[model samples]
Target: MHADILLRGGDIVDGTGAPRRRGDVAITDDRITATGDLSDWTAGRDIDCTGRIVAPGFIDPHVHHDEIVLTDPGMDCMLSQGVTTIINGNCGFSIAPLTATGPLPQPLGMILSNDAPRFATYAAYRDRLRADPPAVNTACLIGHGTLRINEVANLDRPADRDEIAVMARALDAALSEGGIGLSTGPFYPPARASTTGELTEMARVAQAHGKLYVTHMRDEGDRVIEALDETFQIGRDACCGVHVSHHKCAGLANHGLSETTLAMIDRAMQTQDVGLDTTPWTASSTMLNSGRHRQASRVIVADSTPHPEMAGRDLADIAAGWGTDIDTAMERLLPATGIFFIMDEGDVRRILAYEHTIICSDGIARGSHPHPRVWGTFPRVLGHYVRDAGVFDLETAIRRMTSMPADRFGLRDRGRIAEGTYADAVIFDAATIREANDYAHPTRPAEGIDLVFVNGRESWRSGVHSGARAGVVL
Candidate 1:
């Protein structure tokens, strides 16, 4: 058969948690036309994948790449790590369908390392993004804060009835604009002011369209259980599926709470609806230069900043140099610094192994020393964790990184190497895969991944792209 592209002689894992099988994948245009023993398949070009694992490129279910460089939002940081599709506006943060001229700090650039990029709203941003967008397939959520900012016209107070109704109308409009669901950061400023009832109202609109709920939750450490319960209640009341982004128990004070957090999530998943995403890292990063996060200083460590020397040091340690307590030091450094080292490895793996679990980088590659997950997450999972430690089989790990995320997040036409799906795929040496980034050395690329194809065209060669543009803005 004539084919546009043919992946020849690879051991295919297919991303289904099933055993690997040998085959060739034939592609025509953007879709996989067929997959079998295709020794006779003829194509204009062929990629020899002998002794490699050809599988669906990963779909990161939760990521903050919505805040990456919009002008170049190719999602390259993630793509370099073998991620082809990404769910953005996670942790209740997304750029979307709204009407406005944009906002302070503009949600896609680094005005402040901790500062989040904001857009006018889903409708407004969608129009702008359609005019010009970065590469990579993107699915988005309507942020709850944007709705409040749209309807309330103020960020310091609760919404009245008329305000709630207006916000509801705006949310409904976003849903009509192809928003996948609702996302909220109960931890962020404008969103933090909203009551549970306010969230319920917004979620109700999303539920009306069969949308999903994604949140940063009210807490990640001491209040994790309560936050999970609150999340459960939101799903229960709104009748929507709820997903927790970047699950962790952060502080040293919150140590050993991984079991508690997982148990709570398990109970919630069993009884109601709850799902979670985890990045492969021992630290967390955020812009907590003020307020509640500042008050909880010991758990927060700044990974980067305007101050050159202090950029990579932990907050508590930095606090000592400044002759201040941890919280006070946070207040002093918060404006310039970003936070990290929030969770350990114990919780990361347990969460990754959950059947309902999906892998995400929560990838934010900013600051002098950005989060390592941005560069090395997927390879590290396959190389270090699976091949090296044997914590999970390569097939099981691939499922979490690929098809599982695609199924749970409502991404259509990608994720699995099935008939008629988009031929966005990867070829990697299973035995040689290795993630090369660490906190101290954050910009190194992953190893063992040899080729990446987007929409059936070769995009990379050992992390160096061959000047291809088959990837598109979703």
Candidate 2:
């Protein structure tokens, strides 16, 4: 007869690929206890939502906040953006669920050092969350490269049978201890040397335990098709599903390749297993020392600190400005600045419209012109592609960011707005919502979010955060 919180007169999308309808939702404790007309329900707190699209809170399937949230739990960047649940451990670069201790991954260098030492294994990371937490709920996958190289320290060649056995043992340990799946980056430094057979061995281990295989495919430029084929082979051999993390083709040769590439996935999904995640923007951002940037035709200096002159210049422009060769300029910025504005807009539209694709933010909190996607990913999808570009219907677009990812990762109780589910929801004006971020000035807050709730408690509303930590790490 009584509810913990009630949202009245909101348009509900539910994230189930269903049509939107006007209704009310009532929460008891942290679960949605009732839906449909509840105008008569008694409640401890009630919020009027007369003009808003109330949908399941966006669940970011791929994220890179391993260190940011540990230090800055505010998550105002994401919270303000309406993200409730974020899945980290993407691209084999998580600080945690490491099977052993050694040099931390390349990404750990940018986030923070204190967080690095704590990530020896999945259990160690989970133990940390049990004690201290972040503002948004996070489910971490085991970074494959972390487990393999952290223990062995180096595996440029295929692992021996015995070495493979050791890594598999450590991987199984992490998965059983609550790792969501296996994340690997064939495009990162430590992961670059990993051979297919070694990855297949780990994939089998994940498949055995019902975990996923998410990969930064071996190559996305000249060898993209080959890399994708290799991924499909691994899934087929391991008998598990595979996800392509931040699927994109970089460099001039790679522009406009998404249609062909997604066609490959569409054909593969008919029988074999494969999927992808992409941001709703043309430019993908990343650390300078990353494999993709190192091999890119040119790693533009989007923004740089300690060198303001080069902040907004591209690689060619930076090279010209500094009176140095492009490679020399790239070498200089690779140490501190991250780059953006590198992918094809045509490809981005093609991938977002793919039926098998989900959306994700492979973001860095510290980048100087970080692709606005970091702050505007989910909101941009709702405002631009769905409402403006007419790429997908409201129901379908939200599903890619919500239920599609939740179901892919086997998260059972959260994505959809349903009775007995955790009431993580968002209320925003569909007509007014839009991303204010751009490559020139990337930190602008999005417009039009009226409210955000995690676990049935208000987190943000009407341009002000409600100062609550309703998030509980999973």
**lDDT for each of the candidates?**
0.73, 0.79
Name the runs in model 1 displaced over 4 angstroms.
67-69, 97-124, 131-133, 290-309, 320-328
Q: Return the TM-score for each candidate structure.
A: 0.90, 0.94
C-alpha lDDT of candidate 2 relative to the true structure: 0.79
Task: Quote the lDDT for 145 in model 2.
Answer: 68
- What is candidate 2's lDDT per residue for 281-377, written digit by digit as tens? 6666665555455445445565454565666567778778789986677677745455645577778888888887898877777655556778888
Best by the TM-score measure:
2
Backbone collisions counted per model: 17, 3
lDDT of each residue in 167-257, candidate 1, tens digit only: 7887888778767778888876667778888888888888898878888888887788888888889999988888888887776677678
Question: Candidate 1's error at 142, in angstroms?
Answer: 1.3
Local error of candidate 2 at residue 123 (angstroms): 1.6
